[model samples]
Target chain A: MSTRWYPIYQRGNPQLRVFLPNFWMKLVRPTEEQPPNVVTFAVSTEMTKHDVKNYLEKIYKVPVVEVRTRIALGDTKRDQTYGYITKNDDVKIAYVTMPKTEAFKFPDLFEKKAEQLEKDEKSMDDSKEGFRKFLERNKKRPGTPGWFSI
Target chain B: MSSTLMKCLSLANTLRTATLRSLLTSQQKPTLAPWGAVVPALASHVQAVSGIHTSAASLGLMEFFDDPKVWSENEVKVGRAWKPDELRIKSNKELHQLWYILLKERNMLLTMEHECNDKMEVFPNPERIDKVKISMENLETVVRERNKAYHLLETGETGERPQRLVHNCFGLRYMYKSCEHVLPPFMNIKWIKSRNVGFGGRAVRKFLLQYREKLYNEKRKAKNRSRNEVMMILRRNPDFDLEVLRRQFPQVNIDKLRNEDKARGHYVPKIGV
Candidate 1:
């Protein structure tokens, strides 16, 4: 059953099964300190606490013990020049709790960016120095080709 | 001491042989279960047995890519997106299964794309995501078509959202989709009163008049500007194609425009010999 429509539950009817769920959940870093077993997620607005629980358990294979969700009000500000007000869309934040034994920490993806940049700059400098030396060696004989070198 | 050492060596040898035998027997057995028996066996054993192997091999999350080993490879080749004709032949159950697989693939692609952007690296074969998106859209369209047909057969309505033309407070027309409401229109006194405050007040009429005038003036000026431009072009180039100008500006009357004094070129025409 799609989340858009739900049939009324009868006593003897079978439980509903969602064949194609359209909900999406993105793991995000928490703005505040959180428990080691708790993870934050930005999920589809249509998703409920139960949906978040099932999504983590079934799709992500995470053992979700409990789920809590809240709608975060987006910021609103008046335009500096026009004086018209604008607001961003509200986002649904889901806090999924895994088993006590499980622990998760957001990995630092950009940790080595500075190091990589330093290495790149080093190589660039080396190439520039090599080209300068080559030019110095051929200063006297302008027409002489690079192949003439030892 | 010598007797004790000899006894320990014999025990170790026996243990070693037992371990070797068990290892050989385990190796002789199937490396893995055929995937059919791993899940609950269906009532129809023959159908389940045949379907399991085929579905296990071809369908589901397992077939999204070549394998884990191919992840580190520089390049991997795959066929084009699934054509509509090929998907049309599949059963509803199979199509449903394929939808989940595609959804998972799209998620995986999005994750990779996000990581690539974060790393400031060019995402390889970005078109692969587009192909998957197109395939999913086509699949959804096919499903929706079938759903609409089935609904029409069962129910009198088209099983789509009920919508009708509605006017807003500003008197602008828009389609309003009717949805389920907890209270009737009569009971909803606030809504009824708000809706009763219909548009087209004296103030609104004045505003609308100026707004319409503004639109009309812009259009009128644009048309006049284009007409003047056409005349200037004709005056500059007497040999200019009338058919091209006529096609270019459909609003201007080319025949009447050609006879105007402004349309005549600066140089005098030579008299007939």
Candidate 2:
């Protein structure tokens, strides 16, 4: 069943069926190269392997062959001044194997963003240069109004 | 073709309404029916309810959006959020039906918001999401209240998580909520080991003493600083409202301080008979 709260089960408890499962699974790019059917997801830490499998199969209607999950320890860094170490919360990474018939490739969201970034940088530089020129022009005529210039 | 779309739209609306009602009314227990078996029945019910509004060129669930006439309009008028009293008056079945309708409405709003964010355009009526969230929260609160009352009546304990104030290893006080476990406390070696590791050490005692001293020092300095500030203010502005100063700095004894030399102004005082 889903991660929703339910009554405790007795010895011969019937299978619990979750009506509305609220778990969200985001498809993420795998760091290392893997088989075509093997996909990775950064799921909620509380999610179990079965939950991930059911989530993909039921919600997204994707055929899941097998599911593996691991809680990866987050990076810990020591502060330069304080010397105290800070650690990020561990994340549950799910490696799901889909049916061979279906294949998924993580699409690059930032592919078109590179050109936009270049244009933004160019505009920023132009503005900075313009401001510098304005400052130079007013340097010789301190307190003199800009309207007084030719 | 148009009629089919309208039918689907209506079905979704009905389901959404039903879900919302179920979420709101805690008194009504959900009939434990296998979802796979009841899917067809639920679908048919949705279709039956949607058939009522089929005359208007059968639009899909998305058809619940603002009319094409108002698409370009800057603003759209809408009613306020559904009050708890109004929802409470509705029958359980009606509420259940309404819940599904609201859920669909919420999903539609989220879809629209996502599309707007992607296009870098302003989403019309952003408050719609807030209204839906508020309604959902209120419904959950109502359900929780009913659940708590039921549990209190049936059992001595509340059906919520049990919590208690506890001092951690750092000697800091915090609320620790107890939860269910497969193993008993004695059997749970990991939990027992962790609990054993928590608190009681010479280093911890030293740290707690320093921490408390630091806190006390801050409080004492603050009080002394305020007292000095009041004295200075009285010395400069002798005619200042003593009542207001005393009220503002409760820690400072303004009445006794008022008779001090520092509180007396530089101006000559007239002798009293």
Best by DockQ: 1
Q: List the residue pairs that clash in candidate 1.
A: none
The 10-residue segment of model 1 chain B with minimum total lDDT is B46-55
lDDT string for model 1 (A1-150, tens) is 122455556678799788677676566667899999988776788889999888766664568889989999989999999999999878799888888988877655445556655865797899999888889999998868778979
The residue-by-residue lDDT of candidate 2 on B1-273, one tens digit each, is 566656655644554456434533556333211111223334442121111111122233222243443343333333345567656665545555455545444544554554456556556677867776676555555555656777889997677877798888898998886766778999999988877656788999999999999999999999889988998999898789988997899889998888888778787876893
Stretches of model 2 off by over 4 angstroms after superposition? A1-10, A14-24, A78-84, A114-150, B1-157, B166-176, B180-216, B250-252, B265-273
Calculate DockQ per candidate and list them.
0.15, 0.05
Q: lDDT of model 1 at residue A30?
A: 76
Give i-RMS (Å) per prediction.
6.7, 9.6
lDDT of 2 at B240: 95
lDDT per model vs. reference:
0.64, 0.62
Determine which window of 10 residues in candidate 2 chain B has minimal summed lDDT: B46-55
TM-score leader: 1
Residue A38 Cα positional deviation in candidate 1, in Å, after optimal superposition: 1.2
**Predicted candidate 2 versus true structure: per-residue lDDT over A72-120, tens digit per residue:** 8999999999999999878788898888876666543334445655765
